[model samples]
Every structure is written in C-alpha cells, then in structure tokens.
Target: MKVSTHQPSGLSAPGLPSPSLFSSLLFSPSLFRPYLWLAAALVASPLLFSSPALAHHFADLGQMKPTLSNGVLSGLAHPLLGPDHLLFLLALSLVALQCRWGWALGLLLVGLLGGAAGLAWPGLPGAEALVACTLVVEALVLLRRLPPVLLLPAIALHGYVLSVPVFGWSTMPVAAYGAGLLLSQGSLLLVALWLLRPIAKRLSPANLRWLALALAACGTTWAFSAWAG
Candidate 1:
C-alpha cells in the first residue's frame, strides 16, 4: 500500500482569513460604496436644509414660554439642530483637534462670556453675518493661514448668535440656558477631541489642507447665501 500525502486546497488555518476572502474585502468596490454615499449625503446636507430662518429658529422657541425647562431644552437643541451652527461647531472641533487643550478651553470660556454679553445686549448688528464669517475664519485657521488666537472672537460671535433665542428670559431661565449651552457645546468639543485625536495624528498635511479648503468653501457659500437672502 502506498501512503498519500494531501491537504485541502482552499482551507485556511484557524483564526486566519483566507487569501480570497481577504482580497475580496480589501479590493471590493462595493465595500466602499456605502461610505461614499454617506460622505456625499453629509456634504449635501447643509445645501439641502440650510437657510437663514432655520439657522436661528431650529428649536421652535417662538411660542414657548421662558422657563428653566424650556430654556435648557432650547439651548441643548439649538446647536445640534441648526445646520449653520452644527457645521460651525464641527469645523471648530476639527480645528481644535490640532490645538493645545488650553486654547480650546479658552475658546469655550470666551464663548460662554459672549453668550452672557449677548443676553445683556441682544440684537448685535450683523451678528448673523459674523457667525457665518466665523466659519471662514476657522477654515483659515485650519489651513494655518491665520492664527488660532483669531478663533476667540469667532467663537464669541457664535456664542452671541447661540444666545439670541434666549434673549429677554428671566435670570433663572437664562442661567439654565447658559448651562445647557455649555454642557452641549463643551461635550461636543471634548468628544470631538477624543475621537479625532488619533485620526488627526495620522492625517497628512495635504489631507488637512484639503479639509480646510472645503470648510472655507462651505463657509463662503453659506455667508454669501445669508447675505443674498
């Protein structure tokens, strides 16, 4: 009798991927289609939903009474709901990912102060324009064309715009609203910092530069649309 030596032709070892399986996953165009669609949707969202009216009135506070509960709810929802505000914060987070923690915190503190100032002095002229312009300034900062220190005034303007809805509320409600804003915006920044830290470290300068240019284009378009409308 002759002994035969043979092995399975296509079997991979335990806990290891087969070459075919790995290649399919790595080289499959379908695998990346969903990601492409998602990116397109994200890029188109602001154009589809953004408007001057929606920018400041996202929380439907028009008829709501100024109460602690309403203020808190409004504050929490305002930034998340408004496309302009959301975009600004997202851009700010990306920018912050490249900066020192102290600078980021200082921006947050300055934003809080700006909110307080807004409550005291509502209806800052060209405030909407200013808010829109902040995005452009942030993009410049991201590109290293402008200093990070410039973010301070831009964030302050954002705070002022954020507080516009809470204007004329009583002290208690106003305080509650401010707390909510701090909680919401602060949490957003912190989370962005944590999540993006690794990605930021790995990003090439060219990639970051492209991101900055995209942000600048978005900001410029939004600002122009606001002015036109």
Candidate 2:
C-alpha cells in the first residue's frame, strides 16, 4: 500500500509561517468588527446619560462676561463642555470626509460668520427646538437617509442660534468672540477631520455603520433632553 500527502491551498509548504496577528486582525471581518462597534457604543453611553442642564449652561455663555478674554475662553469651552456640540462636530467630521475638502471649512466659516451676523437678525422664534432638530437631521444625513444639500442650511441655522447665547443682545463688536469661535471650532474640525481620514480608512464599512449608529443615539438623547426642557 502507498500513502500520499496534500498541501493546503494558501500555504507554500508544510512548515511556512502563517500571517501575523495584526495583519490577521486588520484583514479579518469576522474578528474585529463586532468589537469595534461594542467599543463605540460604550464610548457614547456617557453622553446619553449626562445632565440636560449642562446643554443649556454651555450653549449660553454670554451670561458670564462680554470681555474679550472671556469671550475667547467661552468660545473655546462651549463645544468641549457641551456633549451636544462636541458630538455634532464629530459627526460632521465623519460626514465631511465623504464631501469636498472645503466642505467642513466652509461650514465653520458660515457658522462663525452667521453667528456674528445673528446679532442684527431679530431673534428667531423656536430657535432651541430648531437647534435640537439639526442634530437629528445631521445624523440622518450622515447615515445617508437625507440629501447632503440640506446640511448647509442646517449648519447655518445652528450657527445663528449659537450666536444668540454667545453674543447675547449686546451690540458690541464681536471681533474677539468671533475669533474665538473660529479658533475653537476650527481647531476641533481640523483635528477631527484629520484623525477621521485615517480612521475611516482603517475601519470596515460595518464598523463605520456602528459609528453612525452611536452618533444617532447621542443625537436622539440630546433631542429628547431638549424637548423635555
């Protein structure tokens, strides 16, 4: 009787080393995708449960003082302090990756400029409700359920609303505040978009889906909190 041996399809020979663990994880859809989603969900959980009062407090910083330094600090602190705004920018970073390079910068410019101009515009009624709605709309657009065209107007509207609190009813020059707004939001946008460019590459499409889902959850939480208030 004679015996024969067979080799596996991908292997060159019996003793060759297999692929590295990092490469295997990087390439394996079955292994890391679910874990990434779980991690994202866990990260978003705190934002969902945070106090609703914080949203009101941070969104309106003009009550402190109208000084230049204060304005700059307030501007820097608003987004970082408010989960609603921070998450909004995070979602925008991801969405902008799919848009033109100037898209994110344009939105920031429009927002800061609109806020500066919002001083003259008569206070828009139901502005709070509208701002809350923008989050939901943004999430929808990110998930590709809504047209991207709507994003510009929505962000402009948010800028206008944000100005009311930051500048209040004061007629003073907003040069400093405007500069601060630009600096704070611009820095965040640049960093977030920069970071997300690589992340979007590394993450599987399925992992990206979960990130969108997490954003939607955060938006829903903020909207509900705003509505309750």
Candidate 3:
C-alpha cells in the first residue's frame, strides 16, 4: 500500500491554522462587513440628534392616575426619553444575542419586575455612575473579555436603575407602566436580535469585536456626560 500525503487548498499542511494566523483572522476588519454599518450608525446617532442629550427624569413627572393609557404612555415614553435607558436596552439585547436568549430574556423580565416591585423603596444613589458602569461592563461582556455570568447581575442592576425614575407611582400606574415598558423594550429587543441573528451567520469574530468597541465608545460618552452633569 502507498501512503499519500496531501493537504487541502487554502489550509495549512497541518490542516489547521497556526495560533497567530487565527488571531489575525479573528481581528481583521474585513471579516466584519455589513454589520459594521450598524456600529457606524450607533456612533453617528448622537451627533445627528440632540434629543438623547436631554436626561430623562420620569420620577419628577408629578402625580399620575392609575389609568391604562397613562401607564402605557409612560412606559413608551420612558425608554424613548432616556438615552441611558436606551443604551442599557441596547446592551441587554446584545448580551441576549451573545448568550442564550431564553436565559437572558427571562432574567431581564425578572429584573424589571423586581425593580418595579421595589418602587416604594428609596432610589439608589449614584444612579448615573451605575448606569455608565453597566454600559461599560456590558460592552466588555460583548467583546468576550468578560465572563457571561456577570451579565445577570449587571442586567439586574440596570433594571433597578431604569425603574428608579418611575418607582413612586401608584400601584395600578406602576403595574401598567411596567407592562408598557416590557412590551416596548421586549419588542425593540426582539427586532434587534432577529435582525442580528442573520448577520451573525456571516460575521467574523472581528465584527463582534468592532461592535463591542462601538458600544464602549457610546458608553464612555454617556458616562462622561452623566458624571459631568
């Protein structure tokens, strides 16, 4: 019997890439194609619109009746009004995409409900810093530089921070508001996750890294503004 030695084209003679080569391929920008556009958009949005600069202070909205309309409107408006809230939501979606959606999404709901339940409790101090830190941590998690397990606690904290503004509302209003927020945020997250799932199939690891970097930049800017103000 004759022994044949052959290697596949475009592969090393060993039939596997060397560590350095693999790392290079992983970090190469060309790997991230269509999705890079999204990172660019995230970077550009704040510059294009001035609305995000305004801090959302839902807590100060004065008294509201326990009506369904008010609850839904408040729920819809809160996430839209606060850039911080939006940032946190974006981070949550990203984590859900990276990890198991069922687990991540479930924890997100639990956190939100827990937060709403604690509405009567005093608001957390240093909320701005906490939010900024959460964004930063989430970006790191997305980059694969942090453990996925930490995400649960971070997301839970985010829920608390997000709910703080509307905590003092009456029971019916708070319940209704929580429902609205869940609907709005859940819809936004589902859409984003669905869109990204397809793109992820074609994306290189580098693309995810770039996306994380973009998120980090946004988080940094948000943190600075929050701390400054």
Highest TM-score: which candidate? Answer: 1
Question: What CA root-mean-square deviation does each model show from the true structure?
Answer: 8.3, 9.5, 9.9
lDDT of 1 at 107: 79
**How do the residues 1-229 of candidate 2 rate in per-residue lDDT, one tens digit apiece?**
7866785554224585333333445446786678966786687678788843365445354456666676666667666766766777878887888887577778887787567556678477656656667777887887788987787777777677667655453444256666776788878988776656655657677777776776666666666766676
CA lDDT, every model vs. true structure: 0.74, 0.68, 0.66
What local lDDT score does residue 207 receive in model 1, on the 0 to 100 scale? Answer: 77
Q: What lDDT score goes with residue 30 in model 1?
A: 87
- lDDT of each residue in 106-220, candidate 3, tens digit only: 7668668556544645566655656666767888887778887776666666567666656556777777777887787777777666655545556678877887776677667
Which has the higher lDDT value, candidate number 1 or candidate number 2?
Answer: 1
User: What digit string (tens of lDDT, one per residue) describes model 1 on residues 1-229?
Assistant: 9988986565557786454553444335787867765886687665534774465754454688888998888878777777666777777777777777656766777988888888788887777767777878888888888998898888888888888777777899888887887788788777666555555656678978877777677677777777777
Residue pairs with colliding backbones in model 1 are none
Model 2: CA > 4 A from native: 1-43, 51-53, 56-63, 168-173
Ranking by TM-score: 1, 2, 3
Which lDDT value does model 2 have at 51? 48
Q: Please give the RMSD of candidate 3 to the true structure.
A: 9.9
For each candidate, give its TM-score against the true structure: 0.79, 0.73, 0.71
- The candidates, ranked best first by lDDT, are 1, 2, 3
